[model samples]
Target chain A: MSDTTILDQDRDAGFGDYFALLKPRVMSLVVFTAFVGLLVAPGAINPFVGLCAILFIAVGGGASGALNMWWDADIDAKMRRTVKRPIPAGKIEPGEALGLGIALTGFSVIMLFLATNWVAGALLAFTIFFYVVIYTMWLKRWTPQNIVIGGAAGAFPPMIGWAAVTGDIALESILMFALTFAWTPPHFWSLALFVKSDYKDADVPMLTVTHGRRVTRNHILVYTFALAAVAIGLGLTSIGGPAYMAVAVVMNLWFIKGAIDIWRRTDADSEADSHLVERKFFKFSLLYLFVHFGMLLVETSLTPFGLGGWS
Target chain B: MTQIRATHEIHGRRLSRNIGLGIVLVAFVGIVYGLTIAKVGTDPNDDLGAPWAQAQDKAAK
Candidate 1:
């Protein structure tokens, strides 16, 4: 009886648990960026197929999320931000998640191959492996440079979406990749600023944990500067236009200012939530990427009427 | 002890709940699967041979 209770204490079940494992918030970003990539490509991709590709991309992203939760169940239990995930909450067993993840992985890629070019399908397969193997299992727990390097997995969606339609990669797609890659460190470190103990307790070596808050802040500022350059540079491409450039200019300024503000502040000064400026910046950073990517969709669509590209 | 009965009841409740949760997961996968194949690759074959084949064909005149 004691042993049964012990085993049972290790589990919990709820509908929300599996949903949480999907990392819906992260999947939303993946979908938004992938959709922008699809919309902005320089050809007439079938809208239905484009929509299908986006669906599969979103599912692929969710599969990665599920696999990540399965792998990180140990540390996820310790972090308040991650403690409620399916595996950690005992809603789903790790084996079940792995099985689901693998099955979804196969379905997304194979279905995509049937619907799109093998190029796009191959890219999808690599992305799953990149996030699950390279980032989650290897880089994340092993290195402080995890987000900086592992950031590539999150960045590849736009490229994948572009490949889905074009059956090839392009400069515009790479720029889209660059936008998300450059934005990740600052986005993550800022959250780490507030949840310092979670990473520490979880024994995960987030930038803030290994390098101290000051260093992480400085790194955020640096990445923000690089991100600003990428955004503005993207504004000069064939995919760029007045709408995208306008969004880029405004968002870049705000993002850089936020990073700069964080860079100049100390941990002791930021401890009080009464100000909430850091939290505000972190939240804005989320919207910042979405709006900029969303604007690209607007810009590209507007091209038919002479509102895009150097004009 | 009375605690033993409570623990057993809790475990029973959890197993039932898990099976229920599993059913929903199955349904969700079916939906995503149906949506993926039903919607995506119908004309995606065009994207492969060349970009915008249909549009070009329409304007060939």
Candidate 2:
């Protein structure tokens, strides 16, 4: 697949493939959490600046995805999960992907600064660099620990949301970062467990590939525990309220229970069975993060009424 | 193969296009500002976060 010559030259760019390169699923979470962070923060930002900040943040998130796809084009072509990606299908060239990613990354960071503050802008810059240079190029092939550490890049949006308001980091913002950072391993490993073939085919090192399914399951359980703790702990903070805490308690339990089911499964159907236990958890994981953050929005909404919050 | 277009060939086209696109972007921003000043100093609503109006009530009061 490194041959690059293998790409289908006849394919034209479709809206969906271009969208796929942006990794809209990941972008949505980034937008949602960043939006919640902006909402919960104690200060005010101009509507124009706030919109630009979110736009740039979304583009930065998308840029990270493009670069990831570019660097992994070789591996991506080999895996069933990504074999149809724009570059692999020759709908977009690897070089095009790289150019788009680098330009957007620079544009996003600069736009973020103009729209918001330097602190948020700087964090956006670091997040893009870390995801591309640090994780994709350096860590992913070499270590199963890649996602665990690289997860920090994904986790920065909420903090960026906070910084955009306060122009600095706050305990509340850090807690949001911590919550997402802690949640990453379990979220990714669950997906890895089901699609172990994707990693194996790509020659990528994932926890399920390196350590085996049971260990992967155990890792998911442990990380899920830590993530749950972080979510609940945020409830005890200035930002959290009865509404947020209630949502956190219910969602975290649902998440942990999902992880537990994955752990207890003795049969993962390694041979094309595509272990549904982890698959189920992976799908739930996306909903888990969105709902948790959405609940924060709910708490903010109900704060005036004084009925649905912690304080 | 009918004709071999090297990677560099496609990339050269993209470079020119992007550069052109970037200049156009700058021009667009300038137009927005120029028109605004010529008319009136109108504030644009570009804020992305939730309005402080809701959170103000929930604030640590």
Chain A only: TM-score of every candidate? Answer: 0.91, 0.89
Q: Score the docking of each candidate (DockQ).
A: 0.18, 0.08
Indicate the DockQ of the complex predicted as candidate 2: 0.08
Give the TM-scores of the predictions, in the order they appear: 0.81, 0.79
Residue-level lDDT for A184 in candidate 1: 86
What digit string (tens of lDDT, one per residue) describes model 1 on residues A1-311?
69987776656554456667788998888898888888888776766678878988988999999999889999999988778777777768999899889988998898777777899999999999999999999888889889887788999899889998899988889999999999888887787777546677777787777888789888989999999999999989988987888878988998888888888887777876542667877899889888889888888777788877676
Native-contact recovery for every candidate? Answer: 0.17, 0.00
* Candidate 1 lDDT, B1-61, residue by residue in tens: 5454445555665676688778866965775665554444233374433444566566785
Interface Cα RMSD of candidate 1: 4.9
Best by lDDT: 1
- Off-target runs (Cα >4 Å) in candidate 2 are A1-19, A268-277, A307-309, B1-61
